[model samples]
Each structure stands twice: as C-alpha cells, then as structure tokens.
Target: MKEFDIIVCGATGYTGQLACEHLARSYGSELRWAMAGRDMAKLRSIQARFEVPSHVQLIEVDITDAAAAASLAERARTILSTAGPFANVGEPLVAACAHNGTDYVDVSGDAVWIRKMLDRYQEVAAGSGARLIFTCGFDSVPSDLGVFFLQELARERFGAPAKTVKGRIRRLVGGLSGGTLASGRASIQAAGADPKIPQLLANPFALVPGFDGPAQPVGNAPVFDPDVKSWVAPFILAGMNAKSVHLSNALLGWSYGKDFTYDEMIMLPGAEDADSAREAADANIWSNVVRALQIDLKPGEGPSEAELAAGSFEMIFVGRTASGQEISTTVTGEGDPYALTPRIVAECAVCLTQDGTTATGGVWTAAAALGEPLRRRLEQRAGMSFSVA
Candidate 1:
C-alpha cells in the first residue's frame, strides 16, 4: 500500500493551497495526505496560513525532476495537481502517475492538453491501473456531472437516455484569477508555436480520439433557444465542456447513444427581447475579455474572499429523447466557481481513493470514472447541490 492516500502536488501555489486547506479542514485526521511542492518554506507558510492540521505531512516534490516525480507517485494512492498551464508543467508528474499506477486528477480545462495526455498515456495508464481524471474543476465538472445527473434521471424515468442535451450557464458568477489568465495565455502561446493546436482545439470531438458523432448544433451565435425559453450567448468554455461531456459519453460505452448531440451556452440575465439578448451576449463576451485583460492580478492571486463569497451559480442541463421526452437537472453552487473548484478536485481524488468506483485502469473524465459517488460527495460535502427538475 502507498504511504499516503493522496498528495496535493502543487500545494504551495494559489489553487493548490486551497486544495490543501479543503482536505485539511474537511477530512483532517481521517485522510492520509501530504502537501507537496519544491519550496518547503512556502508549504510551511501555507500550512500556517490556513491553520492546517498538524498531522498532515509536508513533502518537497519538484515535478521537473523526472526521478523525483516518479518517487512522489510511488508514495500515493492518488495525486491532485493544482498546477496550471498544465500543458507546460503537468506532463512529467502525469507520466509518473500513469507509470506508477497512482490515480491522478487536476484542475485543468484545456482540451488540447487533455487530448495530448490521452494520446500519450492512455495505454500506459490502462496497463498500470492508473486513472488520470482531468478537468475536475469549474471548467467542466458542473457540465459533465450535470449531464450525468440528467441522463441518470432519464434512465430511471424515461427508460432511455437523452439523444439531445443542452447545458446552459445560468449564472457563472465568479472573479477571474491570475492563474486562469496565465493558463489562457499559455494556450495562446502554444497555439502560436504549433499551428496544429488551433486546429485540434477547434474540433468539437478533439478529446475523443477516433470517433465523430453527428454534427452538433451551432453555438457561436446569439440566439433564443426554444428548449429552455431563454436567449443564450456563447460560453467561452462551452466547447471544452462539450468535449468533456462527449468524452464521457464515449467512455461510458456510448450509453448516451451513438447519435447523442450536446451543446452549451450562457443565458443572459434579463434579456427579454431578441435584439437585447444579442446585445447582451456581445457585451458579455467583451466584458469577460476586458476584465481578463485589465485585471491587475498575477499568478497565485485571485479575487478577494468577499468577491468569492459574493459569487454563486446555477447550471441547467436539459436532456431530450427522440420522441420529445425531456428531463432536466440543475447544478447549483452556493459559492464562487473558483472557491468550489478546489473542493471538487479534492473530492475527485478522495472519491478515487475511498469511494467504491467500478472504473479501472484508464484515463477518465470526472463524470465517467467517479460518477454518482462523486456526485454524492460534491452534493454532500462540496457545497453544491444537484436537483432533478
């Protein structure tokens, strides 16, 4: 058995600190975990800052060191990484985890990076019984698991899955973190370096290696969706969420159906008319871009606690069958998306360790690998609720 149940690999970093705090405060002596990073002083400082439990060990892990990375993997049942631009700094530890049979999870929303991981380590992880679950954070969890919950209800009530499902971001009330900006910049830089990255990221099925479902609904435009009776705009991560959701569908033996169709959008708060909805959609897009460009924050710094406390969200998922049968679910969060991300990712690692999951030995999505158990953890412990409507 591994010496530790889980290791927070970037425990000194911004989001990493929160992950450590979550585990410490929520699980405490019940979990065997460690905080890992290159600088022991920073780890100690964070431990002090958060008033973390004394028994939780602190270890130095320089993921850039290949041998050290492997050694860290050898000591844990699972590792939850909070390192961002994971495309740049995440591969070494991921490789180590896959080879060492240590389950892994991260708070990355980058589809390009995930696809790269899938291509490189799918077979290795499967062979070693390692599960690399990615995008456990705000980027895709609400959408991924929201859809999972809706489909589950459909199975129970409608006797079949939904062929068409839509994810709407009713309220993604959160502040932009510097680390998130850096990740976006890193992706842009990567795309500049490799032309093919843009092509891959643009593909809706980029996360799925060998299969393409039917063409999806057009989502780039501002329109009033009749399904939900709301005017919707393009969500920046809708494409990423669709990829994760589609990947979940594939991983679950296409239980959602070979012809399953999915898309995501942002619902304008009070756009009662078509023109106003279009304007709001455009404003919403640019406001986010301007905020990102103008925010005077750096990596490891994010919204103030008050700002985070002021944020909340409700993501609505609508699942539809061929005969017009519809079932929907709402994923409601009581705090900032950023605040909730750490809890979600931490629970993912915990779910992998403590929850009895049927998944074995493969790169998996949060929804596919952990499924209902994880949903339960988030609902019960992660300050989130899933309501079937």
Candidate 2:
C-alpha cells in the first residue's frame, strides 16, 4: 500500500498549483494525496493559498535527484506531473515511475520529448506495470478522446472501423501558457541542434517506432472541405494529438483499422467569405509571431477566474468507413483549456488509481489507457461532454 493515492510532482509550478487546487476542491478529505516539489516554501505558499487539507502532506523531492524521485514514486500509486519544459524536467520522474511501477500522467504537449520518452521507457513501463501517460490535458485529450468516441459510434453504425478520421476544432476560446511556449521553444532548439530530431518531429509515425501506416495527409496547410462546409486551418496541437491517436490505435491492436488516417485542423466559419479567417488559418505562422511577441502568460500566471469561466471549446470529429459510411461526434468542454487542464489531469490520476484497465502497463495515450472510464469521469466530474452529432 502506497502512502498516497496520488502525488503531484512539480506542485509549485502554475499547472501543478492548479492541479492541487482542483484535487483539494474535488476530493477534499477523501483522497490521500500529497504535493511534492523541490522548493518547500513555494509548496507551502500553494498550500496556504488553496487552504489545502491538513492531511495532504507536502514532500520535497527534486526531479533531478534519482533517489528522491524513486522514493517519491514508491510513495504513490499514481503521480501527476506539471513541470516543464519536459525535455529538461520530465525524464527522471518518468524513469522513476517506470522502475517502481507507479502510474504517471502529465500535460506535456512536447511531441519530440514524448517520442524519446516512449522509446526509452515503453518496454520498461510494460514490464513493471507502470502506465506512463502523456498529453492528459487540453493539448491532446479532447482530440484523442473525440476520435475514440467517434470511432466507437462508427463501429456501431457502420459495422467496421473508420479508415479515416478528421478532427476539426469548431470553436476554441483560450490562451496559451508561458510553460507551453517554453516547451515549444525547447523543441525548436532541440530540432535546430539535431537534424534527426526534426525528421522525427515531422513523421506521424514517430511515436509508433518502426510501424509506419499508409500515407497521411499533410494537415499543416489550410484547406476548404465540402463535407464540413468550412475552411480549415492547421491546428497548432495537431502534431501531438495525431501521434497520440495513432499510437492509441496501435495499442488497441488497430481496432480503428490498420490504414486508419487522422488529421486535425481548426474550422473557420464563413468559408471563402472571411479574409481574416483565411489569414488566421496558418497556425504555424501565427504561432511563430506569438513566440516572437513573447506575450503569453508566464508560469504561475493565467487568466482571471472570470475569464476562465467564460472560456470554452467545441471540437467536431468526422469518421469515414471504407464503405463510405460516415459518423460524427462533438466534444464540448467548459472553462479555459489551461484552467480546466488541472481538473482533467487530476481525474486521470484518480482514474488510474481506482479504475484503470488491466492492460494498463505501458506508454499510453489517455484514451487508450483510461478509455471509457476516463471518458465517463470527464463527463461527470470535469467540465466536458461527448455526444453524437
């Protein structure tokens, strides 16, 4: 029996603090969880601010210290991490969890870093019964699970898996965090330093490792789709989400079809009528401009409570079977993506501890590892809803 049901490492970071606040608010005295970080004073500050329960212990565990990380993993059945850039701070904790067989979750959207972690720890995690899950937050969760939900519907209706799925962001109201930008910068820097890193980043099958599926559509450009009757722009997080969805398919024995195809883009209303919409369709271009502006909220800085409450997103997934049968579903969520990420991640930790699948020990996507249990939990506990359109 571990001492804690969950341990939130990097508890002093902005997202970590949010996770703690959500855990405290949602679980209260019910969960036996603790906050762990290198800076005890910052951890204490979070505790004071959130009025964390007295039973919620605070542990000082440096992520870089292998021994301390191992001890921290040993003390918890599951660990939710928010520290980043993950390339710098994520590996040690992942290694510790894999070795100790402790389930782990993180909100990292760094695809390059995630690929490295999977390559290094997948077998170790599988052997040790540790479930290492990444992109549990807004970056991939909505897209990943939305595809899962749509595919399930497709199977039920079409009597076969959808060979192709398109994830389109219908509406999104939110802002990016400084931590997210930092992770992006880190990946960019790494790619600049190593040419092979860029190649891996470009490949949709990078996470699958040696398993390249059929030709995938290049979703990095804007296109007009007659099916959805909208102009679609490249989605910034599509790279990360695509890999996770593909890996989930692979992990589930290609239930979605061996030739399954996936691509994500942001849907802009008023197709061909709005010039500004066409300009906004280039996500990479705007992302670069935003990075140059450096106006994103810093770590521990985010939208006001009112702003977060006002923010929301709705994503539409369209799945097409080989026989041309199509099914669609919508995943809608309330609140700002960053603000609600903590709750999503917290519920993932809880689900991992209490109701995860038996085949859970591996590097997994949130949809593949937690599956319907998490999907239902998000609908019930988190501010998310999934339904057929």
Candidate number achieving the greatest lDDT relative to the actual structure: 1
lDDT of 2 at 35: 97
TM-score of each: 0.96, 0.95
After aligning candidate 1 to the native by TM-score, how far in Å is the CA of 224 from where it should be? 0.9
lDDT per residue (tens digit) for residues 1-389 in model 1: 88999989888887899888889889989999999998999999999999888888999877878898899999999989997669778999899999999999999988888988999999999999999999999978989999989998998998999999999888878877888888888788888999999888877889888787799987887788887788888888887889999999999999999899999998887889878887787667323444455666698998788877888988888888988898888999978888899999999999999986888888899999999999999988889999986
Give the TM-score (vs. native) of candidate 1.
Answer: 0.96
Looking at candidate 2, what is the lDDT of residue 319?
A: 85
In model 2, pairs of residues that clash are none
Score residue 229 of candidate 2 by CA lDDT. Answer: 89
Candidate 1 yields a Cα-based lDDT of 0.87
Candidate 2 lDDT over residue span 1-389, tens digit each: 88999999889988899899999988898899999988899999999999999899999878888888899999999989998888898899999999999999999988888888998999899899999999999978998888888888887887898899998888888776778777777788888899998788778888898897898889665678766889887777888889889988998889998888999888876657456665665343322334433665566666677778888989888888998988888999999898779989999999988885866578988898888999999998889999998
Report the number of clashing residue pairs per model: 0, 0
